[model samples]
Target chain A: MDERMTDAVLATEELTVRFGGHVAVDRVTCRFRAGELTAIVGPNGAGKTTYFNLISGQIPATGGRVLLGGRDVTRLSVAARTRLGVGRAFQLTNLFPDLSVLENVRLVIQSRRGRDFDMWSMAAAHADLAEAAEAVLERVRMTDLAGRKVAALSHGDQRKLEVAMLIALDPKVYMFDEPTAGMSVDEAPVVLELIAALKAQTDRTILLVEHKMDVIARLADRIIVLHNGALAADGPPREVIASDVVQEAYMGKALEDV
Target chain B: MLKRILSGDMPQSRALGLILLAILIGLAFAPFLFPGTRSLDTAARICVFVALAASYDLLLGYAGIVSFAHTMFFGLGAYGVALASDGMGRSFGALAAGSLAGALAAAALALLVGLFSLRVRAIFFAMITLAVASAVAVLFSQLSGITGGEDGLNYRIPRALTAAARYAEEPFLGMRLTGKVLNYYLVFFGALILFLALLRVVNSPFGRVLQAIRENEFRAEAIGCRVVWHRTAATVISAVSAALAGSLYAIWLRYVGPDTVLSFEIMVDILLMVVIGGMGTMYGAAVGAALFVLAQNYLQALMGAAAEAAAGVPGLPLILDPDRWLLWLGALFILSVYFFPTGVVGRLRGR
Candidate 1:
């Protein structure tokens, strides 16, 4: 990883999202530094997911701006934003369950290669896409299950496949929502290792939304806490964890439990 | 590694191959089984419904957009063909013109409707399509002069085909299509071509993008897919297919009426067919259409003369009437939703 974090890959300014009468995300400004892993931690219904959604363009913000590498992208569509090098992983595994693991990655490769509209040509015939898909799967240590249908894979494997798809996009920034949501202790470490490996390979910025403090402590270079649609604290993990506001937000719950 | 293919594989390819073989055999031998004029007519009618159902499947099953106004396109095509060929005194060119007009009309409606309805999910979209369908029906009913009022338009056979038949002393080739076999084959071949074309489209990258949209529209949009454009393209393609089927219906029936064009029954039939066969599978449309047509035919046959006299069965209760087909269809729809959520093909593929 590059020692110099000189660039801001993703920056949010007064970002807010509202659903009808309820404010899901309040005005918040934050910047994700390049070559750093940042975690967005919050209690349930704290708007962490909502913030992620706004930044990723899953839902348009009611007010505020989002910038990707100094370029304003508040008006861009989700797809346009993605093409401009922003990738996201959903909290719920969003995959073509019937497709093979390799086919899943191959689809991302196809999109990246700009062959998404070639109707007459077979996707399987694209050797470069296949190679890139395979390489990403190998990076995630999922090559052995490449031919297996996504539906047949274990939850952990499916999560790995999701990460592999994000990696295939080769985005300048990756936003992950609950990356270790349903993993066993052993499985969580594997995913953490994979994320670390991704960080090592590229100077890409990462915004990880996680409930697991251990994973956050191990992976996050900086941490932000959200409580009821507002920012509770922002600092390094140790400082944020020790903050009185964050502890109150957790209702005196231990950081380990969080 | 070799064990992978034989042991625990989904067997999608094998299943698809078998289904394709079955369809090929059925299409090849349909004329032999339905040798009479009525039988051939029925087969042609089935082809139109199959195409309509397939088009519906593209939007509802594959793209996950529940639309009830698909019949609008079908009706438009039917009326367009009738107006061009019969009313306007045009010849073979009327077919192309009618299809293009219907598609453009439907595409325009889809764009307008999709703009608002696409923002809402599931039930809202369904209700919006229902509203559109109902509105169109009312509009056509009010426009009696252009739409031929309640009596509808009477479509005459093209002069060219009759002249050709007279010139050749037979129908088209030396083969006498004085029967329905020729018409059946013609429509069946058209449906087959459409089915194959759709199969190719669904398997390509373009198709993959649609599936991606279906799986997660937000994720798809984030990945650089223009959600509205992709959806609009699918809608237009589906509308064109429905219009083509409608044109075929107009040609086969040699009559166009408001009842056939504006009825909600056509929409229900298409939906039931797709659901019964399977959603998201290529063969689902054909399977659904076949099953629906056969069931209706059998039920009507069992009802016999009494049903024809009053459009209601004599021996059975009111539930067995021709209109009561919806009750049975509704029951099947519920059962399929509960027991086979993925439909027959989806369940088979699951195993």
Candidate 2:
């Protein structure tokens, strides 16, 4: 355990955030390592999304530190954290609704290359960025819809575009907030396969906050469960699933209310 | 060649393309086509407004920043030139110096505003800009010695650009070959180049980032584009461009006053043009500015003619009264906004 501690790629030390008197994420202390896919499971308002927000620099932590490769990034902006190799995909399918799908992905590619601020050069003039964008879209099988406006895309396609943008960034730590929330049966498999491919690399950390237990069972090597803004369980997926703390935290409360 | 010039961002609609071309040709030969003092003045005003409106569009349309401070930047340019010409004497060097100074000052002030307020909510930022703009307007009027206070500053330009200096012995192409014609061309070409530069910018990588930010700022930040910095950069560029347009307006009028250049009405006019023409496209600025200026200048005369034609026709004559032209203009604006929520260009483009 002591030796494995040093190998952690991403770690949070007692991270917390408060909304007035209420705490959204409370003292989430955990170390995430490369070669691991950790699924964060929780009931609604379990602070799972808030924890992800804390780690990804969406909301500043009220206390404690977020360490990326042992360096504290608690005060960094979201873009600064992204530059430090942290990437995030939103639960809400955040995208450039007015732009074409190709331009949407191309913008991220340009940003990743640090060429987004080249004011004089035409974006179309840079064929390389477009080609790279196409390649990422191809991975998500969205090449046919390249010219389609994002607003015109179906919900599943928008989710695919969201993943394509994240792939374009190619960050070291992938933070996905409900990657397949609204995906259909067929669409979910495509996204799951892509996530599997990323996990196969085994040199980058993947953090997923999800409600789908089946997905957590299939892809997650380890599971971290949160209940009422506190960690309830953390261990191998099966052990964490069977743990009494998990059952009592959300399940028992839900059953009692029912 | 034209495609290259447009940076491959075509107007995308044939009718829109033709309309833009007609506007281009008409402005290019305005003095020759409509040879009169009032017409030339109207044409000059159109050129300056086109550039001004387009620069404002870069913020309101492309980047989705609501800024009322645009006229403040324009005022800075006008005053920059007014002071330079007033202090440095009538010379080409003074014009150049004033124009450059105005652009720089506008850019610097925009940078400060963006840094301080961009991180706030969009509506709040708009309020902040409104406050800043009104403050600047007040400052321009209060600083009497420097800005000429309420009376305003009347300055001269180089002999070559004034109406007294005739370049040729005879009028050419039914237009006098005087310094005034040269000044008109200067305004026309400067506006043209500035409009094209703005077009190119909207097609660039930086411009795409701005669109993305407008679409989803949090996602842009999550994807590694510093949202605030990008917004600030866009604000500076828009301010500088507006300042330059203000410089051209000052040169054309040979006077600088709060009412002439820095008025809030100018800002409201810019908003109307962008919305009426189309918000997101640069061509919208050209079309919107032309149409609005034409209506403002000629709509009353056209109404007077109609009123006379409808003499003793009950409500028709009363409705067509020249003094009530603004009522008709308001009705037209409402009709357009109702029929084309995306503006004329956006509706014409069919996307």
Highest lDDT scorer? 2
CAPRI grade, predicted model 1? acceptable
Q: Which interface RMSD values do the candidates have, in the order shown?
A: 4.5, 0.8
- Across all candidates, the chain A TM-score values are 0.92, 0.95
Tens-place lDDT per residue, model 2, A107-203, is 8889989997888878889999999999998988889999999999999899988988888888889988899988888888888998999999999
Chain A TM-score, cand. 1: 0.92
Give the range of the ten consecutive residues with the poorest summed lDDT in model 2 chain B: B3-12
Residue-wise lDDT of candidate 1 within B3-108, one digit each (tens)?
2212221227567557655755765665565454555556666677878888888888778788888998888888778877765565667766766677678777
Native A-B contacts reproduced, model 2: 0.89
Error of 2 at B212 (Å): 0.9
The root-mean-square deviation over C-alpha atoms between each candidate and the true structure, in angstroms, is 5.7, 2.3
Task: Give the residue spans of candidate 1 off by over 4 A.
Answer: A1-6, A16-27, A41-47, A92-100, A147-152, A210-220, A223-258, B1-33, B160-185, B302-344, B347-351
Q: How far out, in Å, is residue B315 in model 1?
A: 9.0
